[model samples]
Target: MSGDASHRPLDLRSDTVTRPDETMRAAMAAAEVGDDILDGDPTVRALEEKAAEILGTEATLWVPSGTMGNLIALTVHLRPGDRFLAPALAHVVEFELGGWASFAGGVPHALPWSAGPGRVSPASVRASVPPSQPYDALRDRLLCLENTHNAAGGTVTGPGEHRAVTATAKEAGLLVHLDGARIWNAAVSLDVQPAELTWGVDSVLACLSKGLCAPMGSVLGGSAEFVRAARRLRKMVGGAVRQGGVMAAAGLVALSRIELLRNDHSNARVLASGLRDLGWEAASPETNIVLARVTDAERRVSELHRMGILATTISGAVRFVTHADLSEKDIQEVIWRISSMSP
Candidate 1:
């Protein structure tokens, strides 16, 4: 969403578009790095420990991307040809390029959002589990959940709801994996610790490159045994990095500023409120992502792009994500520009 040196487009596509601030850049430059796979990068280990503590897990492994983190979790949890359940339109279902099927060798069974947008009911999950069937039936091995679910305009599943769903899966003998890429936002919005929402899940992945605004990295956390296994799989997938502390250092800085996500959430609410005032059906955002229903998402998005506001379409809705790089003034300007658009 860059225009020129003088006119930078207001990018609302996703939080991933955020650039590392000077603090992050300085940390990266001064990072003490080493061979992550051979000798173990000291800073990478520090990040893993910090993330694990935040998520209340026994251990954690640093991966190059959230997709890779999810893949590693899938590989460890599912055997080849096993089936796993995820909410329909979940990032692992709609995004991730079918890595669950092709790479992880697991079947994806999409659960309807019966509880609400981007949420699945506990009863629905219980019903999805096959009865003590013959050996030929595909085994359901894992349940994947997303907090502040992306495609649903960043709707949050509260700690109680999270426990209910995961408890159901666990009772049915399924391991749970939480795609907690935006868990910090959810925590800030709910006024709870990030660990509260992750208590019942066996493993969770949190991204540093998204709202936290680190350069690039995600951490997967679980039991010491689970992470020990994931470390091997991470290396197998060519994710082994030597001197990875440069990025992990930025992650440390990002973690320190986790509370700052409240600003992004506040800005998103303002953006949605403005869109609603313009006669668009914009839902009140629960976090930093806003979804406005439109007759033609592609056309609306294109129009916005031309007006120097970058946006994307998700499930026939215009998607806007607020992030660290955006300010309250930028939100106001976006509303003004959209209001001036031709009908």
Candidate 2:
């Protein structure tokens, strides 16, 4: 059965697998273009404008990746030798290869968030920023956060928590940057408009490639002056692309189809519930990613591969992300395969 099943492809690796659908392909094929580096590409400009409006910001810039978008935003917000703060599990702190230190020339003060689901408390922020002995003078230049925090099984931080955190950051005169790679999923799961969650944030970087199904792109949004500065930082980091509208066309389709993300979140919950039923421990997913723990995680991953299911094991936890292309049937099949596995 496993051999025969190998002929079928049920990729649950990550939402990043979602390819451009027919409409996206059509848009890309017909997209008008210009030298975005010199004279901004019209399609890229439209996508940036749409993203800015959605994020409730004054302006936006299109970048090639969420990493680039975040790096540019951080560099724009902080100068060399400055310091930024975030939860220890934040993508920029844990996953971005220390770009904040290397590219932005800033130090990271990774404060601990709530353990299981990984939430940062305002008190933690306050304590992390208060002057300590030795008088090191580590000024807090920026506060970074992630929505539907990836390493936390896509947990959604409520708007109240967001406001409290941002309020603290603002009171301290620190600029806040949101790593909203899955902001759309967070909004859908929390049943709030995206803008409401981002209203207090100084700047935001959201990815078009993740849950939105764009082939590749991310938008950095903030005040007009901030975005202008980020644009220069993007070019300085070699992120400027010529005639990039081909990718931006797919991003347009992603924005128009973003409402469907609720379906992905629903499937994620279903997947987590099923894993629980199989006696596998899974975090309660509030968005489109689920984290499950299996005994001898490395061995379990190999077994899953034999069953033709793919997932990532992060520190003994396997991550399963739902995407637009995965059907309910595919989700069920994934659950069934896991059920048959013995630790």
Best by TM-score: 1
> Model 1, range 1-343, lDDT digits (tens) per residue?
1224215589999999999988889999999999998889999999999999999999999999999999999989989899999998999878998888877899999999999999999999999996697898999999999998999989999999999999999999999999998999889999999999898788999999999999799999999999999999999998889999999999999999999999999999999999888888998999999999989999999989987899999999999999999999888888888887653
TM-score, cand. 1 vs. native: 0.97
Error of 1 at 292 (Å): 0.6
Alpha-carbon shift of residue 67 in model 1 (angstroms): 0.5
Model 1: lowest-lDDT 10 consecutive positions: 1-10
What overall lDDT goes with each candidate model? 0.92, 0.85
lDDT of 2 by residue, 1-343 (tens): 3446554767777899999988899999999999999888999999998988888999999999999988888888888878898877788888889888888899998878753365788888887776543556766789998887888788878888899989988887789999999999888888888888797887898899988899898999999999889988888989899999999999999998778998898888899999988888986688888888877777777788877788877757888889998988788888877777764
Model 1 pairs whose backbones collide? none
Tell me the deviation in Å of residue 52 in model 1.
0.5
- Model 2 vs. true fold: TM: 0.95
Model 1: per-residue Cα lDDT at residue 79: 90
